[model samples]
Target chain A: MELLLTYDVSTTTPAGRNRLRRVAKLCEGYGMRVQKSVFEIVCTEPELLTLIDKVQRIIDHDEDSIRIYRVPKGSFRTVRMFGTAKPLPHDDALIL
Target chain B: MELLLTYDVSTTTPAGRNRLRRVAKLCEGYGMRVQKSVFEIVCTEPELLTLIDKVQRIIDHDEDSIRIYRVPKGSFRTVRMFGTAKPLPHDDALIL
Candidate 1:
C-alpha cells in the first residue's frame, strides 16, 4: 500500500534533537522525503509493521506525533502540486 | 472535499521568510494546522481555488512548493495517528 507519513519531533533538547535524526533516518530508509518531516512510502504489510515499530521506539509520546495516511489507490490522479514540488521522472510521477 | 495541504517555503532570505509566515497564516485561515507545515482543510471547490490563488501570489515559484491532496471520502477511517496527532473531539473526528 502507499503511505503518507508525517512527523513532528520536539527539538528543544539534545535528546529530542537526536530522536528527530534517528526517526528521519529510519523514514529515509523506507520512503522518499516529501518534505523535511514528511515521507511517501510504498511497502508491504509486514514492512509497515516493522517501520512502525522502529518509529514508536524512537519517539516520545508526549513530545512527538506522527500521522500515517493511507493514500487510496489512484488518488494521485487528484493530487495537485505547484512550483518546484512537481514530480520528477523517477518519483511518484510514474508510480504510486 | 477534504484536503491535506503541505508546503515547503525557502527561508534563506528575509523575503522568503516573510513569505513563509504569510503562507502559514493564509493556510491557518483555511484549515487546522496538523503540524509545523501541514494542514487539514475541508472546503468547497471554490474555496480551494481561492486558496490556491492566494498561496500562489505569496510564494516564489522558484523556491517554494505546495502540495494539495484530496482526501477520499470515508478514507479518514483508515488514518493512523500516534501521540499528539490524534483526532480531537471537534476536529475531523466528527466531520470529514
Candidate 2:
C-alpha cells in the first residue's frame, strides 16, 4: 500500500525539538520525505504497522499530530504536483 | 463527506505569493484551517467538486500541489490530535 504521512510536532521546548527529530528520522526510515514534515511511504502491512508503532512511541500524544492516509496503489495518478517538487515515483519497484 | 485538504504553494516570486493567498482564501471558505496549510472540511459531494474546481483554477498547476483526502462521515473517531490543536468536531450538525 501507499501511504501519505503528515505530522506536526510541537517545538516549544528542547525536548519537543528532540521528539521532532526522532519522528522525522523514524519516518525517513520508512519512506521518502516529500516536504519538511510530509513523507510518501510505500510499504506492506507489517511494515506499516511497525512504522506507526515506532512513530506513536516517539511523539507526545498530547503535543503532536500524525495523520496517515492510505492511498490505493497507483492512485498517484490523481496526485498533482507543480513547481519544483515532483510526484513520488510510483513506478519504482518495492524491494520488500 | 469529510475531506482533509493539504497544499504547498510556492512563494519564490510575487506572483507565487498571490497564488498562495488566493488558494488559502479559497480553502478557508470550504473548511476550517488546521495549520498553516492544512484544513479539515465537511461538505457534500457537490460542494467538494466545487471547492476542487475553484482551487485548481487559482493555483498554478505547475507550481502548486493540493491533495484532498475523502473520509467517511463519523470516521474521525480514529483521528488523533495532541497538543494545542483539537480534532475537528464531528458532532456539529451540518447545515447543508
Best by lDDT: 1
Candidate 2 Cα errors over 4 Å, as ranges: A10-18, A82-85, A91-96, B9-25, B43-65, B70-77, B80-86, B90-96
Model 2, B1-96: lDDT tens per residue? 666677766565888779877877777666666665666777887887787778878887776777766654554555544444466654553423
What C-alpha lDDT do the candidate models reach, one value each?
0.74, 0.68
Worst lDDT window (10 residues) for model 1 chain A?
Answer: A87-96
How much lDDT does candidate 1 score? 0.74
TM-score of chain A of each: 0.76, 0.77
Clashing pairs in 2: A62-B83, A63-B83, A82-B62, A83-B62, A83-B63
TM-scores for every predicted model:
0.79, 0.64
Worst 10 residues of 1 chain B by lDDT: B87-96
Q: RMSDs, each prediction?
A: 4.1, 4.5
Backbone atom clashes (below 3 Å) for every candidate:
0, 5
Q: Which ten residues in a row have the lowest lDDT in candidate 2 chain A?
A: A75-84
Q: Write out the backbone clash pairs for model 1.
A: none
